[model samples]
Target: MAIAEALLAASPQSACTAMIDFSGRVSKNPKLDIRAPGKLSLSHLLGWQGYRMLALLLSDVLALKMAWQIAAHFNQFYSPLPPELNWGSWLRLPSLFWLFAAATLLFFAYGGLYSSATQWKNYLRAGKLVSMVYLLSLVMGYFYDPKLDPPRSLFFTAWFGSVVLVIGFRLLTTLILRQFEQSQSPIPVFLIAPGDRLATLSHLLEQQLNFKGQSASHYQVVGAALATTAHTPTTVQTILASKAKEVLVENLPDTALASALYWQLRRHGITLRLLPSSVDMLHRRGLPEIFAGLPTLRVEPRFLSSLEYGLKRSIDVFGALVGVILLSPLFVAVAIASRLSSPGPIFFRQERMGLHGKVFHMWKFRTMVTEAEALQAQLEACNEIKGGVMFKIRHDPRITRFGRFLRSTSIDELPQLFNVLLGQMSLVGPRPLPLRDVERFDTWHHIRHQVLPGITGLWQVSGRSDIADFGDAVRLDLYYIDNWSLNLDLDILVETCRIVLFGKGAY
Candidate 1:
């Protein structure tokens, strides 16, 4: 655990240098000063660090072998090309394909698609890079041989399949490696919180870090750190003495003890992590730097780059188009039912906060009566949820007969396909809140607006209307923002289907 923390503390480039330095000393030279800070060159090329280098090499070799095998299979299955065509005429393709594959692999690596830094970042980059490689391969095929060019259909199949296969291969490797590491050298984590808060933090970490609800074999709570100064020093001393790798302080109040304990842990080479707390650590200043070049604190925000944003928008457009086409029958049925059930419009367009806190008219099929808003004030005292956010009663009297059905099945949200097509929402992202909700938000809540709102999101699939507390909702939203990715989005979409079909956690 200490080794992992030390490695994590080092920059990616430094970590690569350290690995190279260690490797060189053991294999080639003995007197190299690999430990000297900032001495190593090739920092940019450090993406080829440690086992990732081996993974890339293996991926290239496998891609080449697969390409050749595919070419052989194609030659066997398809009629022979004109007499002018020969094996030699297409030999350049496999070579060029391998070269492009290697370049794409490196591109993905450099983009942090292969790093532990962020999960969603990795997934997004993988999709875009793989897609780009597919397009490039198609263009390369066109240039290679116009007369004996492979069928466009075959090219598309091979290109998409190859990208999928390559990405799957890498993902499998990563999963296997992670599982092995978890089994062999479980992370040594220490929990520091008031005794009352210990169980909650412990359960959360165990569930997240150690799958299967098993107690984390890698993590151990040395002791609890009180928010009060009277016991803070004693807790810190006890924790340091235990030699725990990482100290996680939970539910710490914004107070002097919190600041003192943080600096104390720093002095002893112990990494401090704060759990989900009401106090805004973002406002704290004067953080003490332990390492020479490292920042004392790190804050990660959730937002994709311009390229990733564009790619995501492209996906949304394509998905929304296909979805609307396929579900046109359902859409028509819902619209007719809604009109028959209620005298209001088929669709509900309400002002919701979107990306960057911009106001947009979010679309949904109306699942309430035309005068639903007018009745909100009268029903305020009957609210079931504790949060300041507005939530309707499970047996709301204002809901039309068809509206109840729509709410239960979540079919009312289907019209958001139009919003997605119009670039107002994504197929999967943080749920867009109303402008009134945004006005009530604190600083941390603002993070949700960093990305475009989604038709279905973490909150919807995780619990939907069942999640009554605003704090839980915010945490889930923050978790999604912190860990967004194409794979995660796909997972949420699948889960959303299950939730909708089963009517789980629906109003």
Candidate 2:
């Protein structure tokens, strides 16, 4: 295509001599029709995406040089190049290092590292890519230079350092780019789905917001067209008036209608994307293929391996220790307040369902009378939040005067750091439930207990005690588990702090 385009662009007649279909068959296109489906204007095609790959390649090479210098600093045989001198040293990397640089970039590209539009934001995947590149480099080195005259330590340190530096560079660059991007207007989008599913689809799209719901002052939903086409003229007018750049069609509509709509919408140059037929099962990544002219998606395995669990536990331990130390003063203050204001033990320990329904003593700073649990049955009839496995009562009689304050402030949850440190919980996971609540849970409800519980979770941060529907809470937990990553944990932690500090939805 590039060759054809160049030939046409250079021709005196300014006409194309041939058109190549996807089948590799050459045909006449004397009319210079370049609007083929798989082709685009060269400038637009080579825009930011090509530049992004080049930038990543440069970053990887720089990371390689930095890794080598840092590794060499620790090796007894090599003299480390100082910072000012390293500028020229990077350009003079050993001939073998040049080979390594090319291989690293190619390996990363092969590993899907260079493909992410927001590479820095996808740190976990990028980290895995870095490890792959490093491992590949090690294997290459072993075969190509077995003796490793520069020292094996050099390669090892460089491997670790490349991961750190490459990620760090991407992280900082992503932040800057994200800030710049937010200033630009979002492309208008038209949603074509069953009216009943509009609300759910809206919420899903808004999750792509910078800050879900709140900071989303501007909405990308420019218009809506019902799949049923109840009012065809209205839908067409809305689409035309809104000038939507994209149309999202739900899988509910028949292919004939989707095809008709696509033909009508494509005339306006609106990109069309069909919503997955099975949104639930496609929550994680999948292998996309074509089967007999129809798109096919195969779901990937959802289980976490032992190594992932071990890494998750290690992070939980470290985060818990840091949190406990940082909040020791608040913990002591809450403990003292609980004893003085509630006339109960400083800590409240109750048997709660942990992983796989294993009972564990979940600890919290007492935020109720000593006999609050005993009074729970009496107040059952008056429970304000209904139709949920968990029970809650507005203006409960059992909450002590200070207990109310403690609960509202979420200080009651401070002691859970100990549970996290003890390995009975994680810093971010499904919140553990009391045995009474567990007893009321259905079989499907037991799924939340598959992972260690936490003090703060998707439910707590999303709506906290305000969420009355047990099924809704369970769904959020499952979604978290299915898509678990370090970025998600950080997001939840930040959101939890915001909710706790604002006293939103707390009793």
Q: Name model 1 segments beyond 4 Å from true.
A: 1-311
Estimate TM-scores for all models. 0.50, 0.49
lDDT of 1 by residue, 270-370 (tens): 44554335235432422232211222332221111223444666778998999899999999989887777779899888998776556779888888788
Q: What C-alpha lDDT do the candidate models reach, one value each?
A: 0.58, 0.60
Residue pairs with clashing backbones, model 2: none
Worst 10 residues of 2 by lDDT: 18-27
Question: Candidate 1 at 207: error in angstroms?
Answer: 42
Q: Supply the global lDDT for candidate 1.
A: 0.58
Instruction: State the displacement of the C-alpha of residue 488, model 1, in Å, after optimal TM-score superposition.
Output: 0.7
Residues 1-507 of candidate 2 have per-residue lDDT tens digits of 222223224443321222112111121221111111222324322544345555666776777778767776776466543332233344665555676667666656644456433332566766677688677766775797676534456657777887898788777666665555556565566666665566555655554443323244333767664555511434555676776655555653332231123333432334455456734433244344322122434222111112344566677888889988999998887777667775768888999877655678988877788899988988888866556478888799888898889889888887888988877778888888887887777645665654567878898887887888888888788667655656688789899999888999889
